[model samples]
Target: MKTEKGFSIADLKMNNRLVLAPMAAISDLPFRLLCRKQGASLCYTEMINAEAVARNNKSAFRLAESHPDDQPLGLQLFGARVESMEAAAKKLAGTEKFDFFDLNMGCPDGRVLRQGAGAALLRRETRACELVKAIKEAGKPVTVKVRLNPNVLNSIRVCKALEKAGVDCITVHGRTVKQKYSGPVDFVSIKRITKAVSIPVIANGNIRSRKDVKITLEKTGAAAVMIGRGAIGNPGIFADLQGHLAIKPINAMFNYLKLFEEFGMDKFGRKKTQVIRFLTKVKKQQVIELVQKAGTEEELEQALAELK
Candidate 1:
């Protein structure tokens, strides 16, 4: 599956076809890098607030960080206002060297609904179409990330507009906004969208195992499958997709703890011993008891010292 032309997002040839879904608060630099090492063809930053980008927020800017190894990364942005989104895309295009700009149209958070972003954009076809057009104008590949809206009878209409508007690829989550993360994912909708669009369609939802990935791709006839929540405490799924082998969840936890620590968890004014104590999930009551007996940070250090 390797391409000599290097990796890309749209017309772009990636090292592999597997991609990590842009999850909020989960797909940070360390997590994406870990997945990449595990054989993820490509990975994206967490879905960032488009309005934050337009306003030049430092936290949002930090989300865009990538290393040399994190090639062909997708930068996902979200917002309701087309103008703001366009400006943010243009700004990102000018500075950040991303393989593609992904529009977030699938988030179901209440705050996102309040701002008319995420799944809310799905209902406003005219506006969503315009945003896609603007992203296309940015000279890079335009990808839209969406979920199946429960009330959307015109799903085909929306897909057609996205295609006609020049979106290079579309990633469809199987669940609707109303359904949130509940129930089974509607793979049928994904199949319908796949048949309707000419470009690559990615199927995402409840993909926890290699078996699920295999079945999903076959059932939906999608070009790729995007893994999200399933990869949080488990990254071996990437390795499994590569046909290597599946490791135990304990092994995954060992790796995640190292990753979390190296990525600055220990820098919270605590020594290594104190940090590892919290990381250990022996029992909630035991942790509370340890914290309760400590009169100060020094006492906490002594208590942890005795345990070790």
Candidate 2:
């Protein structure tokens, strides 16, 4: 599990342990392709709304789109209602786009919390387990992503219930809802979940570099590490974790632009917004302004070239 060799959970296998966490509005087709090319073993779609999918919403299915090369992907779903979650999974059961379905119980967004989903499920462990069981009825492999409980180390208890509910795997994002994404990942809590559950426990939160991957794997004893914010614009971070040469941010952005355009997803400033996520090193106001005002791939390239 520590090595980058093939890891399997309930018959789902990937060549490596590096996985791209589902980021809303960020893990689209083009972006997932970039990550897959950079060696992410599995790239999950952004959390698809179960309510929307169950309601036959085209936008939800569009968000779950994938390319031919983005194989072995996971379709992540988020919803508080078990009936909607079950219906959504049944609807997507025949799709070849995803290899498995992941339930999102760790998103701390205010809107999601208000709906009694995401990390709100972290506080409602019983309902969370029921959601897992509901999706498993669709006959595809299911996993759950969760966060630690505030003021106590109860993730192990929650994960145990999920394991009993027949979850294929579990991803533990080491921060509670209250902590959100700010504090250090609680490696101790993640380690506990890994030990408590028979299923694979993925360690997430604050994994940005090879060093972070090394330490997290060692301390948490997790089967794999999931990267979210760290991989926003730089997909090569996956390759970097394997001790290979990393693609420069500027270079990655150009490649991203090509993927962006080739996929015909260039409307409504989506391309421009993604281009900005790759500017991890650009600190100048004028260069930032140039990127902000740019309208086309060529202009974005020019703006990035300024940093060189």
Candidate 3:
């Protein structure tokens, strides 16, 4: 199960060290499959609200849905309460749907923090440990994602606690919750945490290119690198890392659209918007304007064909 650039963690075997980070609304079924096809070692579903899943919310269930092709997938759950977290884990375990699970402790959104979830757990170490331990009890391999605490050094302490709670891996986003996504990434603190834990450490944040991936692993000694915004419009970034031909935006867009329709997600306007956002990243201004003006699939396809 081990390759030069890949490793196995519990039951999940990754093909490489590059992972597609869990992104809300952006890491949907079509996008995940696209990234996986492009060589991302693993991909996670957007963070699901534990409370909602515990209540059997249909929308939350849909978010966690996976196909056989989405192997080595991980489901991420977010909640402040041990009861809800445990309940959600149990619910997902019963489905036997995912290769593993991740607990979200790194989200910095105001809405998540206000609910005492996400990055708020960084301040409540005891609660965070309890939540992770509760999920582990579901008998699934679990990982935890976290950001540097107010005191950056505290990341090592938190990571050690998670390891003790039996987390299979740890992904550290190198910015404190307060810093959100701006400013510099704290590679120093990430390296400290990697050294502090026996489990694999996955470094996230500011990873844009293959060189960035190499630099992160070299500097932090992390077992892997997780890319988020960098892969927004460019799943080919993974192919680039694997020394494959860089995929053109038009071709990538065609494949993505085909998969999007195959997944029966065409009714969602937000999904089209997601594709448009990716197009904006790689398309010329005029093409972007045409896509922006597109009101239907035909119009969008016409706009995309111009690039071909």
What is the lDDT for 45 in model 1? 86
Q: How big is the positional error of residue 40 in model 3, measured in Å on the Cα after superposition?
A: 0.8
Residue-level error in angstroms, candidate 2, position 245: 1.5
Q: Can you list the residue pairs that collide in candidate 2?
A: none
Write candidate 1's Cα lDDT for 199-225 as tens digits: 888889898766787788788888888
lDDT of 3: 0.84
Q: Which scores greater on lDDT, model 1 or model 2?
A: 2
The TM-score of candidate 2 is 0.92
Per-residue lDDT over 1-308 for candidate 3, one digit per residue giving the tens place of the 0 to 100 score: 11147866776778789899999978888888888888888899999999999999978888888899998889999999999899999998897488888989999999999999998888888899899889988888999899998676677777888888788999999998878899988888899898888889888999877678888888888888899998887788878876778676556777878788787664456656776767777756787777778888788778778666
The superposed Cα distance between candidate 2 and the true structure at residue 179, in angstroms, equals 0.8
Candidate ranking (TM-score, best to worst): 3, 2, 1
Candidate 1 ranges with C-alpha deviation above 4 Å: 1-9, 151-153, 246-308
Query: Of models 2 and 3, which has the larger TM-score?
Result: 3
- Per candidate, the number of residue pairs that clash is 1, 0, 0
